[model samples]
Target: MSLVNAANRFLPSDTPAAFVADAQRVAVRGERVITLSMRHAGARQVALRYELVGAADAPVVFVAGGISAHRHLAANADFPEKGWVDDLVGEGRALDPANRRLLSFDFLGADGKLDAPIDTADQADAIAVLLDLLGIEQLHGFVGYSYGALVGLQFAIRHAARLHRLVAVSGAHRAHPYAAAWRALQRRAVALGQLQCAEDHGLALARQFAMLSYRTPEEFGERFDAAPEVVNGRVRVAAEDYLDAAGAQYVSRTPVDAYLRLSESIDLHRVVPSAVAVPTVVVAVEGDRLVPLADLVSLVEGLGPRGSLRVLRSPYGHDAFLKETDRIDAILATALRTTGETA
Candidate 1:
């Protein structure tokens, strides 16, 4: 059988039901996941779905989240609590799925939606696949955080005229040593059978490690400094609670294999500066370890006149894009307005 046939066969017989259940689950949490059927420019007919955050026809802005699978980005998915992107979609936020079509999809993965191969170029092509399906010949803008940022860059490079503006948050044009190192270990962990999928224990631990670098030491120190005072043999501190929440949630929802594949792919990212000429904004978090401030600068500088870099103050590191949703929203709302004019 051909890949497409195999893919269709691999899909659960109850995919329609499963898809509806997933969407409803997100809806209960004030989010929605809409599945879009589209085919790649080639013969590969893909079942693509994106998490919707805003209204339709207001302006289409594609939000790129997980590189592994679309389900991974679901608010109710078995991952750490959904963050900024979720916060932004409510009522009046920038990319409100209720007001504008906010689409976030996953790239092709290695196995049954649980694994993603680092096909950055193909991943970009997949966006075209989605656009074709949505009957959207062009997008008003594109916004991405971290790995999604790289995917957005790829899209802009390959489909420059397709997007009006691009916003890359907490992402780097090139991989840093810290990111590469973690990714290597993650890949090794999966290869050695230490982790089976993105939500596996080993992969969870690996993610926990990566999560540490995504934030700032000072933030942890300040947040945990007071520690939890012993009370009836029970103690709690905001910092400990925060870390536990993030770590526990991620391990529970995300599959180990999917995490490893996506993380590894994110680690190997390298952007062709010249490939991007769209009016772009590279937002760098001050304390981000995964994506250094320098890297954001490089991306902006590389974009020349068409690119501008903005640094935001956040103790949350790379995850700040989610943690600091309100702040990020303000920036995005402003960017969308400005980006249109500039683009």
Candidate 2:
């Protein structure tokens, strides 16, 4: 038997949500893969690919991450050994699937749903659509990391009643100008690179710059700052090889053309923190170069009393949420549940 069942028992048998289209089997994950098809105002027919695991009756929790994230979120199904948010969410870790209904959805441009970038608002709409399909009146919690954090905050503003708790990691109400400037150059690399019809070189070059911002100077100083290797007539270092590998890997798995579009989406995303009312935890990393600590200070203030600001010191920069599992897990064990609920 499943951990929990008969989730439908909580909803009215004749609820209007019953009008939702039946989910069709799309592909294989661990146990379930379904298509949540809906009409996009501008894009015509659109389907959001998703996967679900854990107790049927447990409060549903949605997980959203970077642009490359997929709906396949099972921990043991080998959904990318190094998935960006994989470390923080799993059966034995924070946001454990054993006790919660974990819902992972593809971003708007994913699965060929749309060819270009859509703002975090577009992604938030997708979540609302999925909740309607599942007949979930309210999510136990919504966890968003990096790019997904923007979507989470936007969802709180647009669909406050649909979520009980909000976890925004490395997100701010608006994109920092310094961060936007860096991404602008990265997007230019993608637009200018001519290595293939796909602009493969552009992504590689952009990733080189992204790597610096994703990590902290302390990490580089201790790990690969001085290691050098002969490349052509000159010499290179571990940092160069690392960036090259990261860019190559990213291009191999991600849509080359989608890179700049999504990067721009991050820049264009903005929201008013005071408008969000759901209990929220905004996670900040002291070393995050992309979304600086200064930005988080303003965000916490804007959220006022409803938002809780958590600051962590990590060597991974903005990427700490992916690496600092123990600290994140402890924090989430409290944030995922309400004042009266047990984690």
Report the lDDT tens digits of candidate 2 across residue range 1-343.
1100112122222323222223221112221223433223354344555556555555678888766666655444423233346667676666766567677766666543355556778778778876776667889899888988999999999899898989999989999999999999888888788545558788888888888888999999988867587878788777887788888877776665456657777988989989988988999999899999889888888988998989999999988987888998888888886557666
Q: Candidate 2, which segments miss by more than 4 Å at Cα? A: 1-44, 77-84, 195-198, 227-230, 338-343
Q: Pick the candidate with the highest TM-score.
A: 2
Best by lDDT: 2
Worst 10 residues of 1 by lDDT: 24-33
Score each candidate by Cα lDDT. 0.63, 0.73
Q: What lDDT does model 2 reach?
A: 0.73
Residue-wise lDDT of candidate 1 within 1-343, one digit each (tens)? Answer: 2222223332332223234333422321112122322222233434453343333345778877544334223243322344335575555677555445566654555333533345455667777766664557788888888877888898899899899999999777778887788668755655555634443555545655666777788777876687467767887655656666666666655555556656767866677876796889889998787788988888888899988888888888877877788888888887887334421
Off by over 4 Å in 1: 1-46, 52-54, 66-84, 110-116, 189-199, 226-245, 338-343
TM-score of 1: 0.74
